[model samples]
Target: MSQSASDQSDRTSPVKTQSPLILDSLPDIPGVEDCSLRVQQKIDLILLAIEALELGGSEYMLATAKELELQSIVDNRVALWRMRCSNPWRRSHVRTRLTLKQGKALTLIASYRARQLTVLIRQLLVAQQQIQEKGLPLEQHFRLSDYLERFRAHFRSRMNPRRAKVAVYLADENQLNDLALSLLSQLLFCTGTYGLKRLWVSLFDGEVA
Candidate 1:
């Protein structure tokens, strides 16, 4: 080939390279990304509480408020993260502390951000009751279908297109439910861009599911 033609060919040629497929592959570490830490911590605490209940029963679990406190701590962290990452300094400066009375009143609000944890707490109490009556397995994996239904119900009840958007996070298994996932996708889109949008769901492994 002529020198000019060879030079032109080289310029037009596509280059092949290999590097770590960080985006394609899930991150090994959990809670490495923004917003994930709070979710992971809450889930872990819920599971731990479940284990404690199975071992000791209701009286034992309620006697200690460690799980509840841990959940609160994670909730505070989520608030802090949102303030730092998204909101302006002026707006973020607003007080987020919860007084005893205020905390009691805001339990429902807390459930919005920590739905899984809240549900787990209720389930633990029920399981404790059941165990007292009849023994049962302690480690229970929540049904994906039930979880999704609860999420959708929560969205339908609280979602305000003018005010806030609904965010749904799905695990890998949940994502495989194409019909449900698509419905959620449509709901999010209809919620609009100006108001709150659904936060993209992440996998248990900290990958985008």
Candidate 2:
């Protein structure tokens, strides 16, 4: 075999030995939501490197994040989150403090549900605009997610099937079984440029059909 082929054949990395994060913890990989396989692999590598720096502290963490260009993503939300969760700052939130259990729960939620939550927040922005246009007639009880559902139905009928399907696929990342697609049109209409970027990423995640 050739030198490259011989090296590839000899390599055998065990799954059990792989780490959860790349560095001391997770670096901001904002593009993971819409990344190519190569980009996704690099994200995994960043996580691993962060995991390895578990005891490296904030200075080292920020330094590494800067080195990796993590701040360039999402106005540095991930980098700022890491900084807030680090020493001195973690215990004193500008918003409020939480118990260890609450903190753990939130961390878990952010890890898996960040995209969902961001979409929800963006949806609320859309609902707010509608409310502004409608003038004063505030309901005593209202649910924005309901508005998202209704808006999707109206928007879907107005859109071509191909375009609508593409929007639905992008919104839910091809989760056909999930009702999240009902918010597709609203999501794109509200979240602006980042939402467009997220939609592009969805295509990479196999949303294109």
Candidate 3:
């Protein structure tokens, strides 16, 4: 059988095999325990975007957590759901707080997955760039189109549209697409050498003094 684009890209990429990411030795950020709501939302959204890109994303998160011995933080599927539901925009919003430990677990899982999907992420971003330079609609790129479509569907179904913030995205497709693209960019960043640390610190952007 012919290799798929993602497969071909992965084969051609220069990533070297490495050990799993372990956060046990790293000291927790000072303000991570007091993470703001926006930080929680951003972290969940980035994971959600990954779910949109890859099939069985939820399962993969669970598997990756166990592989990295982070199951203590991520635990079962319900635990993961509740963590993600901490996002204010979730239709099933729970007023729970995400601790620094839990946040780091999810961050590690996301970063690991991002590294695995680096080739595909780069391809999609490049496709978006080329399409825009040619003044072509995003749908002109099949893989990117599929990813954006899945992202929009996931967002519409999971988010509370009645919420003023989510309502704005519902009202404007372009804004939503831009958000999807932005998340794609962030995932690309997570594929970098210092991506894990960078993303972790970024979660505390404004919340930290």
Candidate 4:
């Protein structure tokens, strides 16, 4: 039996369908608790990015303003968007996304997270510099936190530890420590962690295969 032209058209014609671009998203990270507090979380992430990039005072405010096309950061601060508001603006917002008593939280967390990451990064970069220049002095003799703290105190004046925030980002990416641990604790995690302890325990047990 010959099929009708209608049948042929129905079978051969491409299905007209479209997938709307999926721009709006909140990373469904397992342990992070998103609630009324999520706005603060987003702001905190942005502040870390700002601090890591060394965007200071007006520069920080201006970057957010320009990226979001707001007249000023005061505007940005008020018209909060969804998605993690972070730097390198491309990664900050979703296409169409949507806050809480978020106003107060945003202000507070922004300053707090920025200062926190700044110090953490300054510490990490100091550690990295020491490793490269002198080849890991005192690492074998001291736990990482104790050593890094002493190193920071050794410097007479504040070094502009403004550098890429790889250290902070690395801690998050690595699933290291836990949320309970402070960011500094996460950074200075070369010793005193379960993972490090396990590694040390295995040191003499097996020969190189």
Candidate 5:
């Protein structure tokens, strides 16, 4: 094999042995580049939700990368920030396309973290359900309220308020909270079996023809 191919193999070897949750690679879907924008946005949001769920989330993300043996792609905090900034919605958006390999690494890290936080995620979801069933506001439950508040704060600080899409979310508290809840549900999905593969495919839903 070529040096690049051999190096790639060496990199993935650890992931296979590190955890059952780690995927060697995602399927080679056509037109992935065209869909990368959407993929980047979803990935960033997933991580953002995770950050909201826990204090010092960025640090956890870096540590998770090391724990998952995905540092070759994630590298460090600056690299992580650059990858996330690829999201066009960010205030410090960087014009870069997320490579398939980088996306897979992030998916693995996200699913693994989601699994670790499964109990808390379930509790939050249940609280959300109870709140909706009683027609009560989100803040009625303290933990859920805290998570939603953190999500909104992160969104406001990182997302560019000048953008039209972001302005709508900034103006409407309900709309933004709904997005946070939706992401919370997605995190729950990530904790399930084959969750990484499921999210991998879903990322290209519309772009793949």
Candidate 6:
């Protein structure tokens, strides 16, 4: 066999192996507890979609999104109408239908969001693992707490600085006029307790002291 033929045979061999990328350690955010179970299913779905995209290109994602939207709309409408029924037996039937519809909608939305989040986390994990494997430079990692603190700080700075005082009063006039001096004593006690900053009074056929 010619040297060139041998080289071509080697290049076209079916048993060629590439090194698989392995992740070392994943992020340890507090909310990421049970991370393996929570993220594995998502990661699997995402990887499948990514493989599909590699095979079918952008058309596959668009088609899938469109199909998902159609299903979502149908499910939403069914759930809404089902909840509107009044009869007990019919309501029960409708409620079951609504639950199923909502479940389907939630599953689709959760699956899609999970796929996106998994892709992001996988990218970070791969990059970090690669750095560790190569003994290369390290990048700063942000945890959930750090992100939340920054958010809170930004929100606090943007809020209004002034504070206002408010007071509420409930009064009954019927008891006040009938008991005369007894009502006056009650009014004085209440006024002191309520921190009356100023006093104003009006009297009919009478003079103020």
lDDT of 5 by residue, 25-121 (tens): 5675775553377789999999999999999988988898878766656768999999999898999999998877678878778888898899999
User: Compared with the true structure, what per-residue lDDT tens digits does model 2 show for residues 3-68?
Assistant: 233233325531322222222232223433322333332222222222222232234444544443
**Global lDDT of model 2:** 0.33
Better of 2 and 3 by TM-score: 3
User: Which segments of model 2 are wrong by more than 4 Å?
Assistant: 1-18, 21-111, 117-119, 137-141, 144-209
Better of 5 and 6 by lDDT: 5
Q: List the residue pairs that clash in candidate 4.
A: none
Residue 105 Cα positional deviation in candidate 5, in Å, after optimal superposition? 1.0
Local lDDT at 164 for model 5: 95
lDDT of 3 by residue, 11-120 (tens): 57522222123765345677456557898899999998999889999999899988887654566999899999999999999998886667777888999999988999
Candidate 2, position 135, lDDT: 85
* lDDT per residue (tens digit) for residues 1-209 in model 4: 11243234435662222111111111222332222223334344333333333435335554544442323113354344332332122234343322211232233334333443455555554654576587755343233444334323321121222323423433352222222124333333323323223222232233223
**Alpha-carbon runs more than 4 Å astray in model 6:** 1-67, 71-98, 124-209
Which 10 consecutive residues of model 3 have the lowest summed lDDT?
1-10
Candidate 6 has an lDDT of: 0.29
What would the TM-scores of all predictions be? 0.20, 0.22, 0.87, 0.25, 0.88, 0.22
Taking the candidates one at a time, how many backbone clashes does each contain?
3, 17, 0, 0, 0, 0
Q: What does the lDDT come to for candidate 4?
A: 0.33
Which lDDT tens digits does candidate 6 get at residues 1-209? 33344345435752212101111011113332222222222222222223222333223333443455523222243333343221122212222222222222222332443343444435444554566588864334343223223323322332222311101101322222122223222223223322111111110012212
Candidate 1 vs candidate 6: the lDDT winner is 1
RMSD of 5: 4.5
lDDT of 2 at 169: 37
